[model samples]
Target: MLKGNAYGHGASVTAAFLASRGLPLLAVGDLTEALDIGQAPQTSILVLSPPLPEQLPLAVRHRLHITATSPELVQSLSSLAQGRNQKVTVHIKVDTGFGRLGAAPEELVPLVKEIKKCPYLKLGGIFTHFPAAGGDRIFTAQQLNLFLKLKEEVCALGDCDDVLWHAANSAAFLTLPSSHLDLVRIGTLLYGQSPVSVGAEWDFRTTWQFKTRIVQIRTLPKGHSVGYGRKYRTKKPARIGVIPVGYSHGLELEPLTTPLRQIKHALGQGLKGQHFVFHPMGPLPILGRVGMGLTTVDLSKTPDVYLGDSVTLSMRRVTASAHVPRIYYLAGKVKCILANHEVLSPTGRKISLLGLF
Candidate 1:
């Protein structure tokens, strides 16, 4: 899934890399993301969400596949395609249990029949989603079974032999083999993350890292408070370093949904030792509350570390600030830098995504 800017790895770069690897079809969240990928004539791009009626022209012009969730949308798309004299491929989305955008089970057959009646519409695929595929085995299985049964019914209606049937996301792809139909829409696993455990054979490397240089270094006297809230204070004289990364850069941004998680997050804050940034010498502890654009790190442990030293931070990629420059490396060498919507070489030459890899 090349959606959510390929889950914040940059959709253009990710799409180019995956296309170079010969991935036949790429799926995006909407029409804009598909356009961001530029023109890849050899590879097909599918928009997971239904397009707005006015957006149909561009979608057809780009040959982008769209999701068909209702008879009304299918009819409008068919009319548009017929006017353009082009066949529009559509995937019927069945809402097995995701409770999101898709046709309900009882509505599946009628939707399929509606698509079949359209001369300009081609049924490309059928798919469903799993909301709890990671932990709820029974519920996931139930969803899978219902989707499969719906697929069988659709097949019985004829003209579904070439229809691609899929239901597996990254989580379901890892834990449930039965849910792997014709195609498995995997996103997290492709980015070196898994929702479930896998055997040693599947050795996935961490593919992303967020790092910044130490902009300043200073010392705080004993009992001096730190940060805006003064949430932390030093017992002894302490060395500190400032990095140009904070909550704005997705640092310390975590979702505490449940009460238990909220309590755990609160408890973890009191343990000052828990927050640290990585360096070759050792980990540098974060002193106190993270500011909007700056964070102070306790650097007494790494006295040799100086200004301009780079430190790696733990951050959620999806929430990371887009204003921050992204440096893409290949085989341990800097290849391209994506900054301010332009891709440039290390030597500051403009380049295309095709040349990035």
Candidate 2:
């Protein structure tokens, strides 16, 4: 799915690359995101979220597949398609276990029947989402079983040979083989994020990196406090490197995952540094809480590190800002750069990557 700006990797760039590689389909969150992929006649774009009643016309006009969550939505889509004299493709979102954005399992038969009654609507696919496929096996199994049962019931209604039934997300795709019915909607895994413990075994490589350059360097006097709330203090004279990135840039210094984990980390870091950023020589610890547009890192360990040196920070791909420019590399050479809706070559000349496909 090329949603969340392809997990902040630039949806248009990733979608075009995927299409060029013969990927048949791409999924997005809404109509606006669907239209961001530009015009790709050969590839099918599925809007996973149910569109508003008024948005049906745009979805149909754009030839985008949509999610049918209720009888009313199906009816609305059918009516819109009929008015336009076009066959609208739709996927039935059966809520097997994920308590969000899908019709209940019991509503499957009625929803399918409603869709079948709409002559202008085509049942393109049926799917559900797994909420705990990575951590809870029993719950995932239950959800899978429910989805399969509902699939059987829906298929029995009419000719469902062309309907694609899918439930596996990234975690389910890696751990649950049986959950892979007809299609797998990989998200985090496609960007090299694994929610499972054995994710390292998969031959997936990271497709994104968060990088910034040091803008300033300062020597903090002993006993000087750092950042808001005066969280960190310098015991001795220390060198601090300021990088132009922080919460605003989606670089989270301290990700409070769990209470227990927090307690463990707090105890472990007793008097030592907490979060760190990467330098070729060694790790540079963060001095304090991340601010809006600036972060201070301890650079005492490396004397050679100076202003304009690149610093790499860890970040969640989906949460990163979409405004960041995306530089595409082909075989390790810069091929294209996409920023603010403009496509340019390495030398800054306007170009079209669409012709390559």
Candidate 3:
């Protein structure tokens, strides 16, 4: 379920579930992430990075669909594909008003013509990244106007029958009405999260949950307190659960106006960077500052759970997605996993963790 902390839900599991659901195509921001999931043969890929000649051969072997915007990139890829005897399928990006990637609206027609002249090169599609689909209607409309102008010019140029038109990303796909585009490349949404998913009305629940067993616990006195600076002074003798995870385990604060925090300690002014695995009574903020190597959680209201008791923390992407570890399951069983350092899967009850590769 792509419903919780992305890393906790397990990347391999999410990848597998996406594949099983017939949503096998994934669009990634760069080559590294594309490479991480590249081993999954069932998943077809589209690399959002601009074309690079040196990387084209690897992209060819990996069967990665790339995005190209200029005559230079198209020319470089055309030549490289020819030298390697491999055909390159590329999606053309347009500069609409976004001024990011893609050629200007006026340049789309001529560029397409030049690309068509390359024998080993295949222009697979046309796509534009929305600069502000969820907000800023003025800029989006201006970009739309430019995109429409390019579309009109291309259709009049010739019948480019095989080209696919795609523009909507996760935010636009949900907020904006679909148009003539053939595909909508989703990123944050597939993990059961989004930039706009807020409040109880938000449909996506986190697909990940993080849990760790108690390492050790000590009964503290009322005035002595616990952890550095003695920031938390217990009102009564209380049993607090000790979990092994800390900031190194990859936790983060969600974006503002988002309900993604789980553990609620009395929030100190210093908690901008530190994060934990659980929420507190009545939405307690995080504790004093996050320690360099360790973090303490306020457990006054944590309950009577003893050592070895499971303490779990849940998260959603209220901010951007963070790089975290994931343990994947199938049918409620651990089938595959993505750790900070390895990729592994279960085959016939035997687990395989790719070592250092």
Q: Please write out the lDDT profile of model 1 over residues 173-192, one tens digit for every residue.
A: 98999999999999989889
Cα RMSD to the true fold for all candidates: 2.5, 2.6, 5.4
Candidates ranked by lDDT, best first?
1, 2, 3
Global lDDT of each candidate: 0.87, 0.85, 0.62
Clashes, model 3: 16
Please, what is the TM-score per model?
Answer: 0.90, 0.89, 0.76
Count of backbone clashes for each model? 0, 0, 16
Q: In terms of lDDT, which candidate is stronger, 1 or 2?
A: 1
lDDT of 1 at 181: 92
Q: Residue 141 of candidate 3: its Cα lDDT?
A: 62
Better of 1 and 3 by lDDT: 1
Q: Whose lDDT is greatest here?
A: 1
Q: lDDT per residue, candidate 2, 1-357, as tens digits?
A: 889888788888788888888878889988899888777546899999999988887888899999989999998888889999999999989888788989999998999998888899999999999888988999999999988888888878879999999889888988999989888888887877776767345787768778888999999999999898899899999999999887876876345676766886787578564878898878889988889888999998899998999988877677777666778887888889888877788999887767644
Residue 308 error, candidate 2, Å = 0.9
Error of 1 at 186 (Å): 0.7
- Best candidate per TM-score, number? 1
